[model samples]
Target chain A: DAMVIQNPRYQVTQFGKPVTLSCSQTLNHNVMYWYQQKSSQAPKLLFHYYDKDFNNEADTPDNFQSRRPNTSFCFLDIRSPGLGDAAMYLCATSRTARDEKLFFGSGTQLSVL
Target chain B: QQQVKQSPQSLIVQKGGISIINCAYENTAFDYFPWYQQFPGKGPALLIAIRPDVSEKKEGRFTISFNKSAKQFSLHIMDSQPGDSATYFCAPLSGSARQLTFGSGTQLTVLP
Candidate 1:
């Protein structure tokens, strides 16, 4: 099935260490998004790629960065992991920018220790 | 401003009962509303959606009741079952890129 896939379902990283999460999609959607979700809170948009153009949320931290190497692959890089950065990282894709529904991946559960 | 607000952090319902989750949004420009269901360790899936031009929409056992004038929308799951237990989120989309503003989320448990 055409779907979004994330690598390393569970990731454990040492404090201040760098970690990278990957997402790939078979659906070939035009828009890809990254979101950070802590326990019981809404998923916060970190950044997204429209084709190859990157859009970052105003409040996203500097430690968080993303790259869309190509149409089907996107990566989230944490410059320095912190305890507060432990959360589920979700990747999603949509066909277009207007009123389009997103399809999400299972998510990477990051644990910063 | 936190554009969206959701109620009932958690809810418990017996099998075959009705499950309702509510959300309100502050953005009047929001034209699209969607409800997503998330299972443990899984990503959220689109359950149903509605537009401000419509008051309600139903798909199978899921329904979205939208009150455009009030800036509120709700999801109603009919004949709820254990399989329906999941986290429910209501979101409104607007502006360029149509970025979604989501509610905090409500965890629903349907006892079998």
Candidate 2:
């Protein structure tokens, strides 16, 4: 099954510590996206990569960054974890920009203590 | 301003009843509307989608009724079951950016 996969389904990090979340896809899609979803709220788009071209959302915090070294792998790096940063991080992929359906990974539940 | 607004933060329906979730969007440029279903501790999955050009689209027991003039779209789950209990989200995708702006989401519980 061609699907999106995320590593470390549950992550625990100390305050102000740096952490990285990973996502890989067998779908080989060109566009990869990272979203932060808090409890009972909509998933907020952090950034996305269009085959190595990074596009960050205007309101995304400076502490959040993403990297897509190749077509299949993307990583989300948190420069400094905060208690407010505890949320589910979702990874999604799509083949094209125009009305294409997004495939999402199970997500990484980050806990900042 | 929130581009999309969803109604009824939560809903409870009996099994075999109808489940309806509604959403309204402020962006007139949005051409694509999609509904995603999310389970606890999991990512949202695309359940169904519709385009502004069409008034309605149906797949299996799920139906999306889109009112382009009103800038509102809704999802109707027919013959709801316990397995259908999950969070439902409605999103509208802007045509130019193809980026989706989602609603707050509605948690639906279907009692068996």
Candidate 3:
């Protein structure tokens, strides 16, 4: 089945260390997104890539960055992991920018020690 | 600031009962409203959505009642079951942005 896939379901990083989370999609979606979800909270949009164009949320921290090498893969890089940065990072994809239905991966749980 | 406000942070319902989750949004420009269901250790998946032009949308036992004038929407789960237990979020979409503005979320627990 065509779906979103995230690598390293669980990740542990030390403070100030850099870590990367990856996502790949077989759905052939044109839009890819990254969201940060804390315990008992809503998933917050970090950034997204519409085809090759990158769109970042205004309140997203500078430490978070994303790269979309191509349509099938997108990566999230944390420049310097902080204790507060520990959360579940989710990756999602949609057929188009206007499409309402989003297919999400299982998600990567990041633990910043 | 929470663009959408969801009531009853958590709820418990018995099997065969009805579970209702309510949300209110301040953005009048939001034309698309979607509800997502998330299980433990998993990402949220879109369950159902309703456009402002419609008053309600239903799929199986799940229903979304939308009120454009009041800027309030709700999700109703009929004959709630244990498998239906999960966290539900209200995310509204505005034309200005391609992404969604999510509400705080509500945890639903259906006991058998």
Deviation from native of the Cα of residue B92 in model 2, angstroms: 0.8
Kept native contacts, as fractions per model, are: 0.88, 0.85, 0.91
TM-scores for every predicted model: 0.97, 0.98, 0.97
- Which is superior by TM-score, 2 or 3? 2
Q: Is 1 or 2 the stronger prediction by TM-score?
A: 2
Tens-digit per-residue lDDT, A1-113, candidate 1: 73999999999999999999999999878999999999988888999999999999999999999999999999999999999999999999998766369999999999999
Q: Which digits, one per residue and each the tens of the lDDT, describe model 2 over residues B31-86?
A: 88999999999899999999888999999999999988888999999999999999
User: Residues A5-103, candidate 3, lDDT per residue (tens digit)?
Assistant: 999999999999999999999999999999999999999899999999999989999999999999999999999999999999999999999887889
lDDT of 1 at A55: 94
The worst-scoring run of ten residues by lDDT in candidate 3 chain B lies at B92-101
* Model 1 lDDT tens row, B2-73: 889998889999999999999998988888899999999998898899988889999999999999888899
Candidate 1, CAPRI quality class derived from DockQ: high
Candidate 3, which segments miss by more than 4 Å at Cα?
A: none
Distance from true location, Cα of A35 in model 1, Å: 0.3
Runs in model 2 lying further than 4 Å from the true structure: none
DockQ of each: 0.84, 0.83, 0.87
